[model samples]
Target: MMTVDYRTLFADVHRRPGSYGLDGSYGQAVAFIMGCDAGNAWGLLVGFPEWLAMKAGGGANLVWSALVLRIAFPGPTVVTAAETLDQQHDEHAVGALFGLLDEFLADRKGSRGAAAIVSSYLDWQRLRREQNS
Candidate 1:
């Protein structure tokens, strides 16, 4: 079994997007991260989406990538779903994505209340699961 140090991986991706086939495309970067999360067996990045949504003042309706994109380019920049998709590949958005991701990882590293946020997100997930069951 292999473990992923997502913070280091994100840094690598940010440093050389071309090596990852991202080509400096925000959409592709988002896709790559999402794929990594999906395949993560060690539970790394757990509660990240919830944390991001909370940070972005968004609900769970939008995914983590959408939350990042929204935070990076708010208002009319992503007013509609169509426009949101269009901006996903924007160069500016790509820069913002990596910057925000760095912030996110730093928060995870040692920021005050980082555990509280993840704990709160876990509680939310537990409540949702209980409600559904």
Candidate 2:
């Protein structure tokens, strides 16, 4: 099995998503990332949604992609799912997704390492569970 470095790949994708046939759309970029995660046997995105939720002030119900969308388009607007999807294809939302992803990756590479981040996420999850209980 070949090891894939997703951090570098994400940075490259952010730099030139068109090179990866992404059409500069957040939806397409997310789909591409989903494909990559699906191919990785290790489930690289296992706790990413929780991490994103922590960052974006979202709850467990929202996935990482939704968190990205919320961060990009913070204003609440009444729109159908299709309308929202269309709107998310804009450059602003795509930029936010990749930019946030870069930040997330950087945190994972911080001094304490990915394990520390995971520990923080676990602590957050415990707190949320306690609050719900």
Clashing pairs in 2: none
Q: Name the candidate that leads on TM-score.
A: 2
Assess each prediction's global lDDT (C-alpha) against the native: 0.69, 0.72
Residue 40 lDDT in model 2? 77
lDDT of 2 by residue, 78-123 (tens): 2112236665346777787778877776776667455776687788
Report lDDT (Cα) of residue 86, candidate 1. Answer: 57
lDDT tens readout by residue for model 1, 1-133: 7866777888899889989887667768877877886786625556667777766655567767777777766775552122455544476666777777777766776653557667877677677779889
Deviating ranges (above 4 Å) for candidate 1:
1-4, 76-89, 111-115, 120-133
How displaced is residue 118 in candidate 1, in Å? Answer: 3.3
